[model samples]
Target: MLYALGDPVSLVLLLLSFVVAVTLHGWVQCLVASRSGLRGPAAEGRTRPDPRRHVDPFGAVSAAIAGIGWAKPVDPPDRRNRGALLRVLLSGAVANVVVGLGALALLPLLTSSVGSLVTFLGPSRLLQSGIEGDLAARALLFLGLANLMTGLLSLVPIPPLDGGRLLFGLAPRSPGWQKAEYQLDERNIGVAVLLALMLIPLGGPQALLPTILDTLAGPLVRLVTGA
Candidate 1:
């Protein structure tokens, strides 16, 4: 992905922004999970904002190239409490949206083009390296954009995404839906398909996950920040 991009500084900035966004995204989940009485994250020291605790290498690479990626998935405490499980699943996305909004609020203090700076994620909007502005301005811009996209992408109802898990969790316990959900999770069919959609441009709408996410998030960022 960086093969086609330039500006070593901008690339570094992009990666750093992604790392921060991904770190926060994962940390919030871990924190919520821990506080919700899920011991896995707390016991493993995953409740902190340490990038090493959260960032998945493959997922980070995917985010650098595709603009949307996930963090290390948290292990569930157990399946006994469905509400707690759902809250843990939901926290990552909500945390990102809040991070994005916070960035938007701070951007105006740094640069006048808050709207354009955060919204102009060039070249299929795949987290390219055409960013411009001072160091702080550019960093905040990418941070906001990355976080917003992450939050929204996680809400997409594809298997393995938070939304998908939430959907399957909430589905009526009919034997048919239960069996289907079990098959999807057991085979990891959804994860593979999502990875393909992110990394492989299959010349179809389905393959445009990053683009779709940018479109959904861009307008909102622009309108709110520009306001």
Candidate 2:
């Protein structure tokens, strides 16, 4: 819904946030892979934080609508080191978490600066009062909270997601683990299951996508807001 005509301000904020989140995620993955001695696609040029180098088309659109999206996968070079693989797989998620926290920490500053701007401009008294009220504050809060929720949602363990790769890296190469990997392949039914969870509406006023992100991000958002 990036082009949706409703609520342009919020849509733009969320679109920008999603872009930054995915860029950070891809760059971190490439960095980790490069450091792990794999000069693969990510290490070559995908580490530049450019959308063309990292963002998948469907993934980006889905993210704009669902609040959680992914970037193109960066395959690591042939290496038998499980630890290195784990690091590469987990780096993207770590980057998202870091970005989300940084955004949260900036919320108060953003609102305060907006206040200062309004005061300096000597806006109408009514306008000043409204700005000092919840509008700007809520906007900043939503920006922060949206990024946090998106990052957390990216950590859901399903095929082709970072969390799924994390699990594969962590598990030993046993029969069960191999079976799980096979079943969780990118082209398998796992992707369908994930999409269903994201697209389905369970109850009033909210779909499963936002509901899940909210549930996962609730505690962390509270901690960040000191709520």
Candidate number with greatest lDDT: 1
Q: What TM-score does each of the candidates earn?
A: 0.84, 0.75
Give RMSD to native, each candidate: 2.8, 7.7
Per-residue C-alpha lDDT of model 2 across residues 91-176, encoded as one tens digit per residue: 78777776676665665654544333323321111111222235455455444544465456557777667667666766688998
Candidate 2 is scored at a TM of 0.75
lDDT of 1 at 21: 75
Whole-structure CA lDDT of model 1: 0.72
Count of clashes, each model: 0, 0
**Model 1 residue 39 lDDT score:** 81
Model 2 global lDDT (CA atoms, 0 to 1): 0.60
Pairs in clash, predicted candidate 2? none
